[model samples]
Target: MRAFTALINPIAGGGRATRHWAPVAARLATAGADVRVELTRSGEHARQEAQAAAGAGRVVIAVGGDGLVRDVAGGVVPGGGLMGIVPAGRGNDLALALRLPADPDSLAELLLGAEPRTIDAIEADRGTPGSQGTAAGGVIVPGNVYAGIDSVASEIINASRWLPALVAYRLAPVRAIAGWHPPVFTLTLDGVTSTLRAHTVVVGNSGRYGHGLHIVPPALVDDGLLHVMTVGAGPRRAVISFLRQAGHGGHVHRPEVEIRTAREVTIAADRPLPVGADGDGLGRLPITVRIRPGALRLIAPPPEAHAT
Candidate 1:
């Protein structure tokens, strides 16, 4: 079988997409798999390439970060092609969510050897009502259900000038400290709509967010359920407590945090909201997010990592 590996942003992880290809190519060559490597010129290039190969004929591995995986996965959706990971992207949230090894070699083995399993991928975007806003202002409805925190998305959009995305996140909390600029949005989950002024809201497919943060750690990737978490800045003591738990991946019990589950969710605001899912930017809000179960097949760690 032919195995094509696409490198998505490798700037953060030792430029593995371009730098580590030699060894990986040799290994795949030795294994008798026609391992072809491709360098993505921009954000969605990998997705385009994966779309070109979607089918039972090829096994495509996302050799970069979660963004790359999401792109390729989106492209490979509905096809029988197999997928794997090679965590060379910043945050690598999807990798962390799946418990895949950070090392490329181990991941390569899991990629080339594992039994392919189908998983769910929620569709996310910004720029309409319910999660997206129109110019005049109206919620753009979603056909699927997904959960996400606009705070991270806002940071990425605000930091787009930075060539390396991770650099922006490293400085986000500090930037957020100067003065609070949390956006106000209406979150609708399980038919209950609540307006929340929040610093972050995370919609999770599987438990985890940037670098293993348990924003919705109990989310499962295959349970056909989506997890929603809205984090607001409560009292000063609460903010400190939130930060401590956020840093350790155990912040669920905080009172200021709202957690819910749904099959479809709507989040919208008067202003454009930035969004990131599994780790990719959704540009701006006025958007809709919904879960698309069994949308893609992923090879990764077992159920605990997938327990929604």
Candidate 2:
């Protein structure tokens, strides 16, 4: 018999995940599926739990937001186990990109019938600058890898107490850009190295991030490549305008913006800059990103099929 295990983040979406899981699990139970649910207390906890669940031949489902999904992917990717997502977080870009449903019945139906799709993943190495020794390991980025001003916005969103998630998400970037300055970014892609000043740099396997912003509409998850997007240094107002256009995927036409693809990418800054992967912080810059072909097996609808 097939078993299902859900690794949920209790505080995701401000504790809504706990409430959300009840009906989903009940539906699965009513359907006579073997199901187990585990609530996460911390990042390490989620990783450990997801690992064990996968080892048991259960279809590991992430029942929280992006951070939970990131940690869960960190565990699932190592064994190349099958994984699924239930978007119950602040930013559900991965879910949006994959077109996963959130409702209980629909999710249960999909989980039972959906086939796993093999997809590439970004492996990121965060190492000290000028270090000769290679790092032992790196984080598995199942979605996008971003840094600079967007990370500042993420930090603001994480710290804000006055605004709801949806509102804070929209307002945070405006607030962050006001005091944010572009960093001198050094990038090496597929053996070529160059330096430029940019407001933000994002490498995506899927085109969406920052709550549905189509920052790289050309990105495709199954492709054995990464999209490298650079927003060249400009006035703060111009940068803000660019981001606003990005929400609709119209920023790529700008002269300062460049979108391209590569198999491997390395990034560093003159000073430390906050980094984010799949909507969660992954510490500082000086990181190397490479694509692992067919690294993840995702239980999502066929790529050509329209979302339900």
Candidate 3:
């Protein structure tokens, strides 16, 4: 039997994580897994517990949203430990990208049987002091790191936690776009610098954000490179259209959208812009983001099962 530690965020997904734990635990018990449960008090607490559990040779399973998964990865990655996931939070984008099963039975089965695969992670340095999202001047991003309109939407989503996920995610962007202004952004990709007036800049590893928008459609978690996307300044209608097409990854074809691949990217705006990673705020730019290829060892569905 494999030893497992479930680090749960009870409040994630508006308390959905707490609700999902019972069936998952029962299934794990039936599978004869050596399992332990730890309800996380905060992001830092989750990271600490995951690190301790990983150090003790347990497969640390994050039973929450992408933010919790990112927190757990911060601990598991540095120690080279194995990790698993159960999608129990709003915008479980990492789990979605990995094609993790949502039903408890299949999820438990995957946890018990899937092989650990090496995947890439983003290491973002905010270059200043921050909260739970940053440690030692940086944060581990399991998905994409972004700023501008999307970051404002993230703020709205975070504040509107009482609303349903669908409502919050859908309405937040509209609210953000209404008040947003195009900012002058300076981007340095692998040491090549350029300036542009854009609505947002995204550096992606897993490529999905804003509840399944393919902000960087060509990004792959194990690609050993970062996909940098810039959404150029445009009319509100054009920006809205871009976001709509992003759900199907059609936004990449737009002339206003630019995609580039690099191992490292540095972003600086004319003024400080809010930056977000894995659906949580990570302070403001200028921030430096780099791809840490194969830094995360995740137990996920086989490559053939991955969603396109």
Which candidate number maximizes lDDT? 3
Clashes (N, CA, C under 3 Å) per candidate: 28, 0, 0
- Candidate 3 backbone collisions, by pair: none
Deviation in angstroms for 96 in model 1? 1.4
Candidate 2, which segments miss by more than 4 Å at Cα? 128-136, 305-308
Model 3 RMSD, rounded to 1 decimal: 2.1
Report the candidate with higher lDDT, 2 versus 3: 3
Q: Report the C-alpha lDDT of model 3 over 1-308, residue by residue, as the tens digit.
A: 78999999988989989788789889899888899999999888888888889889999999999999999998887656899998899999988888888898898888888889989989898776553433465688899999989998999999999999988988998999886788999999999999999999999998998888877878889889999999999897687788789999998989989999999999999988899989888888899988888888989987654365
Models sorted by TM-score, best on top: 3, 2, 1
Q: Candidate 3, 230: how far from true, in Å?
A: 0.3
Q: Against the true structure, what is each candidate's TM-score?
A: 0.81, 0.93, 0.95
Q: At residue 280, what lDDT does model 3 achieve?
A: 86
Q: Is candidate 1 or candidate 3 better by lDDT?
A: 3
Best-fitting candidate, measured by TM-score? Answer: 3
lDDT (Cα, 0-100) at 8 in candidate 2: 88
List candidate 1 segments past 4 Å from native: 8-14, 78-80, 125-168, 235-240, 305-308
Kindly report the root-mean-square deviation of model 2 from the true structure over all alpha carbons. Answer: 3.4
- How does each model score on lDDT? 0.60, 0.83, 0.88
**Residue-by-residue lDDT tens digits, candidate 1, 83-176:** 7767665566667666777555766676678777767767654434342222222211111222223354335434553445555544554444
